[model samples]
Target: MSALDPSVAGQLAEDLPPDVFRTIIATFEEDLTRLVQELQTAHESGDQNGYERAAHSLAGASAAVGAVGLEREARIAMDHRQPEAAATVLPRLVAEAKGALEALHALIH
Candidate 1:
């Protein structure tokens, strides 16, 4: 799947005022960065609850911004039952977040 859904991005751009859309994208960027860090820390510390919470929040934020790939990865991370499983998925999740951020940034600039 694409990192960002073009239709969703287009709709967001077309529906909101430019400044509002820019603010949304900026907020999403900040949330994405913070959540990714939370994911990493939770995984390393074996904090399953924190990890899942971060993943869940990340998924929702990603979906809000039409970051399909990141949303998918975040879901996977959220569903992982073991911290060991996270080891395999965390890298992909982080990469997806990076791609999503890049795509979202492209929307405004």
Candidate 2:
């Protein structure tokens, strides 16, 4: 998977007032952190519904921010549905999420 697409985010930011863009990025980051934790918790507990919800949320968030890598992984987890199958891919998904967040952080800064 690729990193966050700054072009998409940059264009999005350009379309908004600077303060509003910052607020959006800030909110995205906060939600992303929470969602990541939710995904982990759901996975650990084998909560299939929670897992799917977290994955779906993450996918939507990443897509909004043009975080391609995380979005792809999230979609994968969301599609698998089976907790065990989804859990098997969590490591890679986690890594991609981290990288995507880092890229997004750099973009905003």
Candidate 3:
């Protein structure tokens, strides 16, 4: 087993493993990418609902990983009356959150 194994950290194999860790990272990355793209599309098309939904999802995912700072930023972005400001903020949120998720995988794997 790897030194970073969750199994060695008093965690059970059934609850954690390298494969599961990778999947979690990949899933988060893919979703974040999609969310950012959707936010851009919404901004381009002036779709307020899409902006809100994507920003909401980004905030939730960021919060899940204890990324309260990013979550707050995302919330502020969502609060902006103009989609341009939200667009400017959404990419940073996605990038930083992706970094956090990758770091999480490294810690567990």
Q: Give per-residue CA lDDT, model 3, range 39-78, as digits (tens).
A: 7898789997888888888777656554555566668667
User: Which pairs of residues collide in model 3?
Assistant: none
The model with the greater TM-score, 1 or 2, is 1
Model 1 score (lDDT): 0.87
Sort by TM-score, top down from the best? 1, 2, 3
* Residue range 1-109, candidate 1, lDDT tens digits: 6689988887898889889999999899889889999999998999989999999999999888889999988998888654547878888988898888788777784
- Cα lDDT of model 2 by residue, 4-26, tens digit: 77677777776878778778878
Candidate 1: where is the Cα deviation over 4 Å?
A: 81-84
Candidate 1 lDDT score at position 59: 92
TM-score of 3: 0.66
Task: List clashing residue pairs in candidate 2.
Answer: none
Minimal lDDT window, size 10, model 3:
1-10
Q: How accurate is candidate 3 locally (lDDT)?
A: 0.63
Q: Would you estimate the TM-scores of all the predictions?
A: 0.91, 0.82, 0.66
Model 1 worst lDDT run, 10 consecutive residues: 79-88
lDDT of each: 0.87, 0.80, 0.63
Model 1 Cα shift for residue 22 (angstroms) = 0.9
